[model samples]
Target: MSTVPKREEVAKEFQWELEHIFESEKAWDQEYDQVKALIPQLAAFQGKLSSAAEVNKCFELEDTLSISLERLYVYANMRLHQNMANTKYQALSEKARKINVSASEALSFITPEILALTNDELDALINNEQLKKYRHSLEEMKRSKAHILTQAEEALMAQVSNISSSPNNIFSMLNNADMKFPKVKNEKGVEVELTHGTYIQFLESKNREVRQEAFKAVYATYGSLKNTLGATFSANVNKNLFYAKARKYDSVLDMYLYGDNVPTSVYTNLIDTIHENLPLMYRYMELRKKLLGVDELHMYDLFAPLVDEFDMNITYDQAKSIVEESLQPLGEQYLSVLKEGLNSGWIDVYENEGKRSGAYSWGAYGTHPYVLLNHNDNLNSMFTLTHEMGHALHSYHSDEAQNYRDAQYPIFLAEVASTLNEALLMDYLLKKSTDPKEKLYLLTYYADQFRTTVFRQTMFAEFEKIVHERTEQGESLTPEDLSSIYYDLNVLYYGKGVKVDEDIAMEWARIPHFYTSFYVYKYATGFSAATSFSKQILDEGEPAVERYLGFLKSGGSDYPIEILKRAGVDMSSPEPIQQAMSVFEDLISQMEELVK
Candidate 1:
């Protein structure tokens, strides 16, 4: 029986060393209490940020308190993620959550108070020696002056922040811990528990029946709870709309883009550009259907292997070495840091019962970043290793290079470093592949990333756009309405080359990214940007490597677009996406030629 292991069954070396965050639960509690105590100190400056001296003191205090609070929160929640059903860590996380809420409510007045000052006054404060370091953060607040509410209103908004997160919390609890799927039959004719982690694994099966069974089985479970999910998803969108309008943004998308200073055109243009070239997807799907020998390529066939009986089962240690080898173009210091993090307790490397599905690299500023991965040994897992370590290294570099206030990079730029890693890995692997079959498989894999990361995510971005816009216009959504929007998008993106399964309609209900408004578009944009950067690094060598490394270490020192602009990819223009599509075309053409 292939069963998932318990958390305790995982070896010490394989698990992350979260003790780096908090030494003990008792230590976590002590810091939690300490954070509570400092909340009052932060509140003490609520009305006193008018002077540069006062603003400096208050901002410094806020940074100190904020750092501690973040550490506490990150540690608690990460512990909970190790095993979500464990109530002991659940209570620990909730306690951290409450303090974070209290801290926000207590310190919420700072931004509004700063915005209340006249421009001349703010510039004078910025000119002050003590406040010079916070210029970027301060200027960002000034940029958002139009949206800053009254201090009282801001405090109320802070209070509401905790409540606003209820939809995500509810959805997560239900999805990760509460919801259950029936046992699914694998390619070997053995039954395995259908889980969020295993769903993708099953879909990659060469056996069509196994893939279809897993796909239908997974979505059927989601479809059964369509009403509840519909309500939950709708409520989340409504929550976004509520906050956007309250902050006086024209739309929820504006509110999201506002923080990173990313123009709405970037989001819309990504979708439009991809739409213009979706025939590329049709060609790929057409190829996929022929390759798989299926009459119609169904949703489950999305990840089916192009080459038969080609196994790239890379073990964890081998993945580490391969990832390290792949990143050689990045120079030595980068490799040294990566190697240390890879070997150290910086990663939680395997799937266990109740652990969160999917993978992410996350940490608070004062510590090294941590990655949560449900790593199944395969080619995809090797790519994931490179991808996530890309994130970890970005965090590691940012923290090392920037101050506490500036170390936190915005979400818009987060995927760039990670996807660039994947790009480099693909380049390394493709160049090093001597076998025709291996090279073909590698080419298809890269092609699929374009399909999934760029095209599929844009399809998702469009679904979010339509649903959120409709709801913003005061229309309500039901299960059927949500499903219809998603289904239509799949058809449009996939074209007539593939069968758009009805179960795919329920697909929207399972994506956790939907809960995070306007976030998925970055994956597409970032992939494009990273692809562009990889070309530069490969072609130009040392100079390009320096610029790219500078980008990684920049943290949140500048706006995401400006940072990328300095690094050579202008995301504001549609050229990067167009270029990325051109590369996608090359891959598809290569596949066609190789197959022939």
Candidate 2:
């Protein structure tokens, strides 16, 4: 039997491929020096951007500088992520970050200067042959021009960017570097220290007492820091409020939604729809309680494995095959790119000591989008593989289809492609599974996805809205205040079926996402849209597949909502969310039958 390798050993197995971004570290440093030297030239165009030709030339130069700088920055950061404890790489990465900030500050005046142009002048510039190449960029500038502050005010805002981002930075330092949990005995009677990395293993422990202890101990740590977390969250809310007020927006929500060209109704609709379907979620909890044979379902019992006697350990190779087969519906082009990404050095597969926890897909222009995963041999990791591959393929398609100016997609639609992969993978597994226990596990997992992606995220969205509104009205939130609000929301969602333990109230402190203003709602909305899109692809076949691929390739050429509509998902209506909830209802019914 093969045992799990130690984290340090794992890092040694896979050296990162920085050659994808730069030929060598020495070459990267040379380019970094060149970029630093070019910084002064950026200021030359700062005040001279009023002329149409000069503005066009300024944007072209800025884009070139941005591209080069991003390549260096991403390469350095990716190297640091591989082994964050390496002091050499860490210093280089920090230098890169500071360089990025300085470059951004230097180029900050470009937007305000363009905003200085009168509407007619901006239009003429857009129509001019010299500037027409940047029509999309110019149009976007014009759209946001109304909200652009005076040059001095814009400079003030730029100066505060570091301070404004401080809440998230503080949360990061505390959570990743300082947070600690109590050791608890596992099913094997082994005392394990509960760090962020080991909490999942403990949560999945088959032993009930072990799971409960781990859950309580983990949240207890968060609970201790609840006041500090609350203040940090309040600071983020104030940051959003400051920008919204400065920009003459109606509300923080309005300001956030405006960036994606979406409306406040979309956010509220998700909350309202999830609330209407609370009974379905409660049914899931009731079923979990019955199946687990527990008198009371504690918060820790939430992630307990439903199926025993099924050891479905998939190797990394096997997981790749499963993802490829599941995503084959998107056509050969999509499949081909995915296959290359997996086979090529596009993924940093598995974790190491000091490496970043969790997974993400990242790359700059002119590079294959690379994914970082802490792969374990399990069904969950398999799904994670497909989910991140979805992101990589989305990036691949967008880069292929659009110029750098319009290549980047918004965060609003980022999860749609990723979760759609999950939907597809879940469907594939369910159809292939034969054993009742295996089927039950898969179904339970799918139900949990709904609980998390839809119900929980909407709850978070509602919490964010309320917190922002309270702050806007001049009410300060203490840690106890946040805990109370969070606890009430949990009780409201879970109903009377599951016990909402006091420690669960400290969940707000543990969610790193709370530091991001009004962002959690996208997870809920994206899952809903994916549900609708996946169903259409499986049911409608070729046309739906074409449109979905088109959606992936659309990038920032259109507003996110409009792009979704072009792909056959009308998020403006509640139908897609309702459809997703109905799928949840069906899964609950299936799980109920299988358990019996």
Candidate 3:
């Protein structure tokens, strides 16, 4: 029997240098104490933020306290994820959470206080040299004055912010912690333990029997909890509605979109365009069915590998060199920084017992971005490395160029960097491959990216919009309602080429992204934008690279749509999405020709 190795058993080189953040547990504790002391100092200037000097003092102190709190929080959370069962780190994590809440409560008065001032008063205050640095922050606050509530209401809202999150928290606990899937036999007829991590591997197995069995086993567990899961999701939707209504937004979608200044038309346009172009998705599905030679393709068959895996296993070191070469269009400075990070202890490269299962690039303002990857020696893992390094490089560029206040980019713009990296890597691989089978596989993989990222996520986005609209229109969302809505969507999107299985309806119950309404659309949009950006960078070279870097360095200073516009892609219009669809269609045309 094979078991996950402990963190101690892993070589030190593969492990991340957490000591770079704080040096030791003693140092982390000292910073935690220092953060606690600063929180009170932050609250001292609360009632006196009217004058420019007072505002500057408040901003400085708040910035200091917030950055410190984030450093402490990231350190604790990363440590906890490294070994969740370790009680020492668990306690440290809990302490960090408590301090974060305290910091939130302490700074709660600041926003309402800023909103209390007249626009003219704010304009005059921001003109002072000392306070000019916060002009963007101040202007953002000023823009939201209409949505900002009274101080009393804001305080009440802040007090219950943690409570509002209970539904998502409860759902997470139920899904990640309490949920258990029954063991399913592998292709060799050996029963293996089923888990969230292993379920994807099962779905991707070459054996049809294994895929179908794992699919049934996992959903059966969720099917049993349908009512409870439905309740939690309903509560979360209503929670979104509560906030939307309170904030005076027209709908929950508007409320969510308002944060990044994305137009409602962008969301509606994606659905409209996708509806018009879904036949392309159907064509891809038909090709899949024909290639696999299945009588009827079930939903479980979607993730099976298109071509056999042979000599495609890429070691981590090989992946680094390939990624570095693939990203050469981004220029020398970008490559230099990325190479340094790849060589240094900037990534926790392999998974250990209790380590986080997925990949992410994370760090605080004062530190180099760090990545956590559970790498397996496969093409998929190779792409995951480039995807995450995409995020890390974006963070690195932003941190190097912007001040701490402006370093954090919004989630709306976050995925573009990552997906663009994927496009570059895919293009590089296609150019380098000579084997017909390998080229077919790479083209199939690229087509699948569109099928999944663009087509599938739009389906999810449409489902979210419908459910939120229903709830907003005084309809209660039940388990049957959610399942039926989701099932109908599958039929509509997948068309008549495939059978929409009954168990697939219960899929909505298992999707965690639904809890965050209107968020999935960004994945679709980001992929489209990234496709356009990658094409330009490949064709236009240095000039395109400069534009892309400028957009990354801009951070949160501008709205997401405006930022993309500066990067040579206007997301508000449908041109980018249209071009992306054309690219997908062209790939399908190329694949059909090659395979024939």
Candidate 4:
């Protein structure tokens, strides 16, 4: 209810020990220097990449350089995120970016050079015992041989990587640094600062007036800059279109999906399935209107708690314990590592002034993964803890099982572990509660996951696909165009029950994910896959647990779909998604029954 604490006020143990990556600033600088020196050495192996020994040598150099470069970049970026106003970390972050660009420029020739080899030459080279370890990595490169341009062109692309990211950088600057929201009165009738953190809290306020005021205030700021935001977003779409065109891909969607071997069907399937289940969302919205006793449910009214009297206040320590208990089916091996990370300062557990908003699990190879959190001591924050831990454990297992070169998992498979943890936690909580009101609250929260993560993300994916296709077709997407499309999607997705507010049309201007097209759909599919797998783990027990663990350990060793298949969820088929929807339906039905 009050302001978030400053970073210094948080106790020592609550913060992550970034020193695990490097002892001090000097040590970080030493690694930074090593990365700068090592990157240029890739030039020596550029033209001489034909031989098996030469190819193997390039991989070895790249492996070491990449590991060092990632650590330096992540360390700097994490420091900057902790306190965005810090000029020292800001410079270090920029320095890391320069090193990254240098590394990309130096290594640009490796792909084209590898593509230059004849099929026979490449096959024989990968067949060698010394080069066998890199076969999967090389094969992946070879798969993109058709898109691999000349060495000169590749170098040009790499050199301009930073320039290409200007739109996202501008958006971040405008959204986080420059933008300010008007102060709004909370439920207590006290004027409070509206922020990215406080905005969500206000939306969850029991007072509808506070929720509506905060929502309108935040959007008003974003709406004022719609043209500028739209221009930046349009530039990003054009940037993706440029790369897709240059690569001779069918569309920007194809180019983005190509990297992970994902088919366009997956994106389409998610949107289609969600649309088919629109009535369920409509039913939920109707229930929201009834519970809030509002004549018409505005967009802001959707976030107010249905069971206002049932506060599931949970502390960080309790969240960790709940996560441990909920994840018991995952076995002791998983729990031990999770507990160690929690106790060993692998988590920055509370929000503070100048700290990054939201949460994520991130780390570079050769270091354990870390979690960033803005703990609000609420039910949502508790669930977020388990969700991020899912990602942390996934990284931990992958790093342990695979070499540095192979440990990095793709984003497609990344959400499964996190969402699965949420599902397990939900099940654990539901089973533990016998109180009808408590059960209704828990079920409502679980059902909201489907609406927010699955359906809303699918809406975003649809919007992204349409905008990119229009961009590719030489259509200039203006602010009006963006808003009109978003509003139409809102109408379709929200159905007739909920009023599609006009100001909500400008919501597109504030979504940072739009800068990266086709990325949000993974949240939908990942949630669906996790839901299906969580049910399997609960129903089938050990076998399901083993398979899911194997998928986590598999990491980037295989394509995302194949890894999921081994884990007993075939995302390629629509069954998992349908099953996830069934879970949503069941939750809604259960909630309705309990409310009656």
Q: Rank the candidates by TM-score, best first.
A: 3, 2, 4, 1
lDDT of 2 by residue, 442-509 (tens): 89878888988889889999998888888889988888888889899999999899899998888888
TM-score of each: 0.83, 0.87, 0.89, 0.85
TM-score of 3: 0.89
lDDT of every model, 2 decimals: 0.89, 0.86, 0.89, 0.89
**Which pairs of residues clash in candidate 3, taking residues 3 or more apart in a chain or in different chains?**
none
| Tens digit per residue, CA lDDT, model 1, 417-525 | 9989998899889889888898898998789889989998999999989998998888988899999989999999999988898989899999999998888998899
Model 3 stretches with alpha carbons more than 4 Å out:
1-15, 18-37, 76-102, 126-129, 155-199, 213-232, 352-356, 475-481
- When summed lDDT is taken over every stretch of 10 residues in candidate 2, the lowest stretch is 7-16
Q: Candidate 4: deviation at residue 348, Å?
A: 4.6
TM accuracy, model 4: 0.85
How far residue 90's Cα lies from its native spot in candidate 4, in Å, is 7.8
Cα displacement (angstroms), candidate 4, residue 394, comes to: 0.6
In model 4, what is the error at residue 79, expressed in angstroms?
7.1
Residue lDDT tens for model 3, 533-564: 98889889999999999987887777789889
- For all predictions, the C-alpha RMSD in Å is 4.4, 3.7, 3.1, 4.0
Backbone clash pairs for candidate 1 read none
